[model samples]
Target chain A: MILDPDLPLIDRILAGEQNVFAELINRHKQYAYTIAVKILQNRPEAEEAAQDAFIKAYQNLAGFNRQARFSTWLYRIVFNTSISYKRKNNKVFQSIENTVIVYNHEGEVSLEKTDKTRYLNQAMMKLNEADRTALTLFYLDEFSLDEIADITGMQANTVKVRIHRARQRLADELKILLNHEALTL
Target chain B: MNRLSQAQEDILLEYLDGTLAAPAKIKLEEELRVNALLRLRLDELRAVHTIFQHASLAEPSRDFTARVMQKLDTAPSPTPSRWPIRNAIFLLIGVLTAIGAAALLIASGVFDGSTSISLNDSSLPQKIIQQEIPVFTFSGKLIINIIIMLNIVVGWILLDRAILRPYFQRRMQA
Candidate 1:
């Protein structure tokens, strides 16, 4: 992918135009929040963690190496910040029984909603955090294994292995969760 | 529908993801042409890949940006004149002063021969006509006064940088 055009705005913000940082936040907040929610599996905490990550990126913008993709760097922060948030709020780790897979807003799911989607969501929640994150990043189709490795601090081949194993596990989970229903896919 | 063996899974995954090198891809393709089970396995993995590729992502709250901006507004601006620079200066002065004081103590032979400084019969020969040592004489009261002043200055800096600075920083984070 081409370098974010917002990199210049980042330069401006680092030079002390703090208000301009709002644009960066607006640009990345959705995927950042999506990443956090995928890991934390909670909407509010994901929102807070994403916010915290942006705040941290703002604080450390001066130290951010320019050669790296800004999204790679920012997503790394989101990933790490969400992990810390998870650790700090360890009590929030609960059974996935209550968490519903969200597809757009509640009423916007006409085309996207299906039994297959529901089963896949259930299977995803059953996967461990690392596997879930690996699968999510892989499925997002926005990052290569190397970029995913950078974001998650794993080696590229390790990321490949992880995605491979996680995919297998997710497939196994979907098969087990859906039983005969999986044949429809 | 079942788990693939570690080796088989790795090859198949690499092939499915198009990450298999040309040689490996050629090998897997050759195997797939003859191996019906391998073809079925590949088809299974392909289906799984499709589902994961289409996995739904979560959406952020409508005001995520505004909430973040509000948090940024309230977050403490890192204090002006970040203490790291000031702390380095303080450490340099502290270390140099400590070294100077140590060298003086060693040169005086305070820790060598005897614990006491009895000028009575020591090899510290007296000058026949004692030249005044310096412009300012070293006396007990003067050393004590100097030490007290040094302690006060060091105390203030320690309080500011170590104690007070961290306490306020904790409060800011809270």
Candidate 2:
């Protein structure tokens, strides 16, 4: 139980120690903001959405299942909230202006950008919402397929398929964007 | 691609993730030892996995947690309300009374003339009918023009994000 602070914090919060929620907020805010930013693609809206998700979770604390990982449950709330907020707010069309379409390591590509993180971020923008979310959870956070399934409301095997397809699609995208043969970097 | 089937890739991924069953693991390992294409495919999968693993985790703005806490502090308490029906009735009554009052005021010619409240109503109409527009000085005009320019710039950016950029992106991709 000491390994997972969420259990104790949850108990304390349920026991009327409301401030114990600050600890939970601190623990999870980065990931919440990360997912929101990925979906919203706008910093201020993502931050607001993440904050709203936290307050929503706190209000609905009793609905949280103790058996599930708090991160997974919280991420689900953030993902859904951000996606809906985006649907309501972001009627924006995406541009591939920042993109460079290179196929798998055929030639020297223009990846002279300082960081692959920026490159990766731009590449991710090209994917649909679902694929980006799935890939972010699976690869970035290392959530298990089952946990991702639970969070994304898909079955475990369905999650596996989604992740697999996302990887292929991402790889294809990166190949085009980075013009690298393999994702060796 | 590779000489790999999608199902085989799935198995390879599960195997790489160490989620594959022991039997499948054993069979895949046996195959990997002698099969070069399978090994190459495995490497490719591993590279993708590695790149994903190394991808950056985003941090929020510095005050993100503090801001969330601040908002939570301002938000309504999570406890269920004790007299929700009473609160709802009071709310409805307040809304209806406000609406009724507005209707009464309007019917009594409030907006037009009778109940209209103004500190300098006498000069307003005379100035409006007799001049080249009223109440805007040079500074006011400059400020208004600046505001209009700002709105146009913001609108253009929004329009680009919402419509033009996406249309062009789709066109470029197509």
Candidate 3:
């Protein structure tokens, strides 16, 4: 028999072990939060979405099929939760003008680093929902194309194209922020 | 538009990242030698990829894990007592087992023993002789009655195992 962690975790859950659920939450919270933050672009909302997803996952643990990886199933829940949160919050796309950009300067390197991160975050915010999600799952979370496809319910080819397009858009946005029109193509 | 073939561009990007195999690397190098635009595009993508790769991983709130578990703890779940179907089935099985056992005892003549008072109009001596006969007789009927009682007990045991045990087990497991 395969000693899969998810299987044992499910068994433990069925055996009236609630701590196993907690262990699962801790184990996958970072990845879940990364995806949520990338989509919602707000710390509080992302954290809330991640929490909701884990709770929902626990409630529906018995319905989990072993055919799919536990992480993939969790990703689906996180994605749906974040999207639902975004809708419920009535957050609409406004212009990207309010976005702040940070640049590196010679003196006070720490402030410059903080500013750059802020600018990167703002740039990330400017991306569309799908692009942001694709970029985060592929680059930040280090998910493979197939895994992204499983999570997003998209084809592998579609995931690849989305990542490519998202990267291109981010590069364009970054260039605009930097005042450098240096794209080779 | 004039552009590099998609395959060639993909290979070029992979090669710049040093992710291409040796054969693919040699092939891409040959192609890059013949194409200047492809080389420029590859370099641009590489620069962008490098920058993005260095982007920091956003740290969530300090109490992220605690907050998540806390939320889970507070989420409302449906009450276990709301399952009327399960309870109804259990009740139905219990009643049926009781009825079936009673019917079996009646069918096997276990409860057919007579309880009657016969007044003898005879003299005192005759009455004494009649009293000598045992009032509660135990013959083959005793064994049959014992067997019928044993069957009912077994039925009760089966009912407990089949219906009640699983329900309690599920509750405990929950």
Q: What is the C-alpha lDDT of each candidate?
A: 0.72, 0.69, 0.67
TM-score of each: 0.63, 0.60, 0.61
TM-score of chain A, model number 3: 0.80
Best of the two (1, 2) by lDDT: 1
lDDT computed for candidate 1: 0.72
* Residue A128, model 2, lDDT: 70
Question: What would the per-residue lDDT of candidate 3 be over residues A48-123, giving only the tens digit for each residue?
Answer: 8888888888777766645567888898899889988887775342221223223232222343332434445556
**Tens-place lDDT digits, model 2, residues B16-103:** 7788999999999999998898887777667667777786767888887677777777766565333643454455555445555555
Best by DockQ: 1
Candidates in descending DockQ order: 1, 2, 3
TM-score of 1: 0.63
List iRMS for all predictions.
Answer: 7.0, 10.9, 5.6
Q: Candidate 3: which stretches are off by over 4 Å?
A: A1-3, A92-123, A140-142, A179-185, B1-8, B16-22, B76-174
lDDT of each residue in B1-174, candidate 1, tens digit only: 354578987899888777789998998899999988788778767868877667666778888888878888866542234466468557756855764675577567553433334344445557653543323334554454466567567756766665565565445434
Q: 1 or 3, which is superior by TM-score?
A: 1
Task: Summing lDDT over every window of 10 consecutive residues in candidate 1 chain B, give the lowest-scoring window.
Answer: B111-120
